[model samples]
Target: MKHIVPVKWLLARLYESDVVIVDCRFQLGKPESGREAYEESHIPGAVYLDLEKDLSAPVGEHGGRHPLPDAAELTVKLGKVGISNDTRVVAYDDQGGAMASRLWWLLKYLGHENVFVMDGGFTAWKNAGCPVSAEQKVLIPARFVATVQHNLLVEVDEVRESLGTGRYVLVDSREAPRYRGEAEPIDRVAGHIPGARNLFWAEGRQADGTWKSAEEQRERFADAGLSQDDEIVVYCGSGVTATPNVLALGEAGFTRVKLYAGSWSDWISWQDNPIAVGDEEARNDG
Candidate 1:
């Protein structure tokens, strides 16, 4: 709950000048649908940020499918949307917090700590019968300064070096089928990085599409037997879905959580990286 706010909380601050609401609804392979949906209706005073265009950079050979946006460019985009350093940003999406959490993680990586993901997303808002508008507000651009947090990210080489070393716990946030190499619809190669544990990001949320409580998130991660002091690096197909798990880990009181920004896609780009099929087994050797 530290990084997520409920619908009622956002509704109360709907008109606050300092609180900026962002609509981050995105669907894979149907990128335009999100904007089209926003054009139809969205929370009043909300601006839309597209996942593939605004949130991610152009794909490269080795940087994964959705690379992290350039900080300077993203800062300009943020400023254009009236997000300054002190602005309290609330990001929402209908994808069960996955898309919204991406914006939240990006803001935190940019050294803006006041951002949060809206719990239950757009569905919860509409179900509550809150005010919706089709009007888009054009506001004066504000100044956004970016102070990048380098330690919050890990490179492919770093992940490779730490394999089987217990230096960090690499968490695969994809679904069980993807992790087990049973199905791979998006990426070129199947399976996950060797030594990585599967922790499907969706588990961070409840069956009702709402996020779990802090204690519940802790219990969800408890199966991993992780300690608060352990170094945790989370990743998914690209680097998007893993964000929810990163935020969830933080909510679970893990102090040293980080993201492997390139994720599985980037890891497989080299072709020389080791890949493991089937479930990663627990090691009994000391």
Candidate 2:
């Protein structure tokens, strides 16, 4: 199946027996806002997945602000949400795919290829005048067996070794200000990985919050000096927003891309890892 589905297409298949819609709306400051919004109204039959509760494990001194949930626990959660090996899952959020892509990536990492992000997300669905419902769905539980793809994830040590190696391209998918160390709203330390290059995750979206075309995405990656053969590793503040960049890279036809699951939050958890600030040019050559 496609990586992304348009609102119209999803509307047409809203009630299909094999489809599972997930509402992933969330705010960093207001963690409960997503569930509140989902309760008020959402796409019909869509289940809610909390970013903090459902999508991530409790944060500790390490592993960034958001850590991957245990595979067995995730399998249980998916089963409870009516997702099975054959289910076609669609996830969405108001913030483009920033929140939803995490679920999409997690599903793929669990070896579920039928998962997709709703292009343009809830905003587009609402604007299109599609029907919304407050009725909660009570789905019969289905067993979801997860076969983890371990190669899709990387650790801090691996990232450190890859720096300036020319064999790997370390990508920081946070905003410009955060990457340049001008301002840090979340993590303790400002700046990014020493040799990492900045590629804002939001660049994957258009002005209307819709994803850019594959052609445009290819151009964006080309402008960043990336080729199809680059061994790319992407990370964001807490490993959340980076998933969208991961999706974008895949859409652009890049074959080898992995997620730095701990991201900057986990990087700064230990003081020994060097952090860099200022313009991209001022940083160490990678």
Candidate 3:
């Protein structure tokens, strides 16, 4: 039920019954790299989940690049991966929990509270000299039901409304350059939403790629002007990377946090939506 699990704990329970380890390593540009890596070698008994194919639905014009997959369909997919209501799930990726947190958040949104993201991700496992295996695991399928939590997500309309009213603290979780519109390598527009403050998702990690402690995380959010009671909504280029910020917010004692699943990609999809460029002060008028 822990939000983050240490690599040592994961290794200790690597092959335990009712425990499922998911490998979520992925590259945004090369979608096949994650599966290829898993095929070569992964934690013993670990199953692979592709960020684009397994975790997200097909990309469309409006829902950003990595949209949430259908809940019923995702439930079936989880069942196929041997995840049930009672199974303890642990997900990890090479890039900290950037990709893995998506799976962690998805499971939590689906009402599976026993899921956790492996701290430091797969890199930590390798660094610690844990054993790896190339043999694929085919688990006995179990039934998984999606008990969706609608409150964890905010639609485009909600984001727009909140922006106008300042009712919610909107956070843009992309890098500073992307938020400042200095450079955008992805998405059509090279800017961010109006009135959004930049809180790069990478700030949640330590120099070694592990997450900071809850005390340190709280301090980080405080430095960013966030408080525990603020109605915070986080978004990024797409919905994927922002999950780590959501996890960080939760660890920092924030209760009213939600993910803007459609993010900036979906925002710019509409011709009417305004784009903000330059410094945060200038973007305030966007």
Candidate 4:
């Protein structure tokens, strides 16, 4: 499944036994807020998914705040959340696709093929005037199968090689300031890959905070002179926000998009690795 399956399309499949609708709306500073809003009202039968609590492993000084969860524990989370091998999972968040996209990537990384992010997210759902409810969902335990798909992800070494010849198109999906290295919000370093292009994930959305049509998104990425079929890779602070880019790229009909799972955080951890800050910065540290 491509990254986006429209909200209306999701409404139709809400009752399918094979479908698992995960509400991934979350806030970085206010971790409890996502659950509060979810408990207040959510799509009927939708289960709340937390980025920091559910999607990530324990945090540490070296690893970014949201470290990748171990597969053994992830299987347990999936089982409790009603995600089975047959599940077609759908994820959404209020702020564009920020938190939801993380699940979209995690599901795929864990080798589940039936998952997609709700384009435009909950905002689009409300605008579309869909139904909402305050009732909590009851889940029946289900077996969640997981197998790591390493090809779906790349790392610092892979990034270095990609930069060696500019053969890989590295796309930065952070906000403008972060992408331009003008602000250091999360990571200690401030900059982007030398040959990378910025497409701020929010730009992939509409004025109403919904994703643009697939065709429009295609044109926007194309404006950056990216070839649709190239070996395109995406990244953000810690392989979290870039999931939207992977989703948008798939929606834009790109068949070979990949994510740098370790992302900038991992890149910066390598002491000998090269670093570039602003635009017009040299492509290689050497």
Candidates' lDDT values, in order?
0.93, 0.91, 0.90, 0.83
List the candidate 1 regions with Cα displacement exceeding 4 Å: 282-286
Q: Candidate 1: give the clashing pairs.
A: none
Estimated TM-score for each candidate: 0.98, 0.97, 0.97, 0.91
Q: Over the stretch 1-286, how does candidate 2's per-residue lDDT look in tens digits?
A: 1488899999999999999999999999999899999999999999999998998999888899999888889889999999999999999999879999999999999999998999998989999999999999997788899999998999989887777678678889999999999999888789988878899999999999999988889999999888888899999999999999999998888879999999999999987888889876654354
Per-residue accuracy of model 1 over 124-223 as CA lDDT, tens digit each: 9999999999999887699999999999999999999898899998899999999989999999999999888899999999888999999999988888
Candidate 1 backbone clash number: 0
Q: 1-286, model 4: which lDDT tens digit per residue?
A: 3567788899998788888899998987899999999999888889987888889888664445577888778888998989998888999889788888899888888999888888778878888899999999887889987998877877677788767696798998887788778998888888877788888887888887777888998899889778976999998888788888888888888978888867778777777767766663334344
**Per-structure clash totals for the candidates:** 0, 0, 0, 0
- Return whichever of 1 and 3 wins on TM-score: 1
Top-down lDDT ranking: 1, 2, 3, 4
Pick by lDDT: 2 or 4, better one: 2
List ranges where model 3 is wrong by over 4 Å: 281-286
By summed lDDT, which 10 consecutive residues of candidate 1 come out lowest? 277-286
Q: Pick the candidate with the highest lDDT.
A: 1
Summarize candidate 3's per-residue lDDT along 218-268 as a digit string, tens digits: 999999888777899999998999999999988877889999988998899
